[model samples]
Target: MGSLRVYATTGLLIASLSTLVHAAKLEDTAPYPKAEAGFSRQVIYLPQQSEEENFKVELIAGKTLEVDCNRQRLGGVLDEKNLEGWGYPFYRLEKVIGPMSTMMACPDGKKTRKFVPVVGDGFLLRYNSKLPLVIYAPQDIEVRYRIWSASDKVGTAIQE
Candidate 1:
């Protein structure tokens, strides 16, 4: 029984000290602030990737709407904002205004709830795994992202 207790105490000490070591290596999180009123902050933790510079992050912010059978799209301006003093990059999604759609009649007034994505500039971002991507958007807005990667082989442009 004495030998068992010694081994147990040693295991506990190793576990506790391991956690402290990992915690010390974690990136600082002091700059990211809480959400502002009427808006919520979203976080995206990217995984470490090889050659991350060849990748891009595309943020899609939009809302689901009941729509008829027509071509539809949502519009919002996604702007990049820098944190005060630290200059850490973050994104803010403006209010989604119009779901401009083609005015075509649906068969038998059929309607369906569809995720209409925002269409605008400033959505593509450079991929960096060191810090999490923070975004502030309206409470009603939904944010999503997809990763894009460049081809390994670079093609030279044709000379004019």
Candidate 2:
């Protein structure tokens, strides 16, 4: 019984020390502030401009970036649908994301309208910002972006 108690105490001490070490590591490497609390989401609304433009976005580890483009709006207005005179608004990421691209030629006319992600009612992109992302979008399309981060310590966005 004495030998058994000695072994048990040794094992407990090892376990406690390992736990403390791990906690220290977690504290040191944690990127988000108050990450022990949980994750958070940030949203951005981009309006149409006269020219095709690139928007730079910052990303962090363990967070995800999601983008959705609305093409059915009438005159760049959200929720103002016009079926008769529908314009197909679209965008392209500088980096190949998922199964989307500007390189893939989308045919013109009503048939081309079917190819838009907005027509399918799904997001144009859902990515983890491995690096800063550059998005290219048409002038008439409005974009809504949602970025999820695991830490609040990040405070303000270092990347726009």
Candidate 3:
């Protein structure tokens, strides 16, 4: 009984240490604050069957992004630009929850939409700050984008 207790205690200590190490790694990787006035761009993907067109968005640091949908008409504003477009009238970005400091892309040439899960969804992209920006089609439709970056960190947007 004493040996079993010792083994259990050792196992518990190992588990505790492992958990601490994992937590430390996560903390180290936590998103850092963006450089002053820094901004990140995100592409909006519309569902294929929907009439709404895909669009590009630029978000400044310390700002929140949101999109939402209702039925057949789509409407939303970004970066102080209010846009009215046709499509699923209610489709709009709700919000972007982030501690993210990087951007990523899908290997399959799809863009990342705000509605898609950034961590564990099929649309989750591999983070890369250097690649051309692209937004995936919100639905099953094929759309192509060729973003031209004016600077290392900014790109010309394509809106349809």
Candidate 4:
């Protein structure tokens, strides 16, 4: 009878300890805090080539959001002054190339080549609350991004 009581107590103690450990883990790892008005830098590189990559962002009211995509390579130094003068970073690793332009087919079967402001490299957007942004890149390209909050501060250079 005494042995039976000891076994029951030991089982209860083990269960209680397990529950406490689980609760502690939950409290330790919490979700990321919602972004407010601030600047953040993130590097995103895909393992394989993909058609498109999407990123979600939360923008505060009356604040503008600007995203700059910089290709990361071993050699070559990024020109801070040139980037500031150009208003944004240019994806010119091999050579100095401009933004991407594509031709779109109209409903009337007419093809028109128009200049799209945002390239595969980077873009500037304005919105309130949460929004999804998409970017297209080549396979296995190492891309670094700089996100800024507030519209008027778009061209302002930030040292990071």
Highest TM-score: which candidate?
Answer: 1
Per-model C-alpha lDDT, please? 0.77, 0.29, 0.29, 0.28
The residue-by-residue lDDT of candidate 1 on 1-160, one tens digit each, is 6965675466446534543444433246646777889998877666566899977878888889898899889888888988899878988886777889998887689888998888988899998877677889998888877666675578899999
Model 4: worst 10 consecutive residues (lDDT sum): 55-64
Q: What clash count goes with each model?
A: 0, 1, 21, 2
What TM-score does each of the candidates earn? Answer: 0.77, 0.19, 0.17, 0.19
RMSD of each: 13.0, 23.0, 22.5, 23.7
Which of candidates 1 and 3 reaches a greater lDDT? 1
Off by over 4 Å in 1: 1-28
Which regions of candidate 2 are displaced past 4 Å? 1-117, 121-126, 148-160
Residue pairs with backbone overlap in model 4: 64-150, 64-151
Q: For residues 1-160, could you state the per-residue lDDT of candidate 3 as single tens digits?
A: 6965675466446534544444433224323222222222233221122111222213221222232231111222221221234111111222334424334433555333333222212222222322222321223222222211122356779998
Q: Candidate 1 lDDT (Cα, whole model)? A: 0.77
**Against the true structure, candidate 3 has what lDDT?**
0.29
Ranking by TM-score: 1, 2, 4, 3
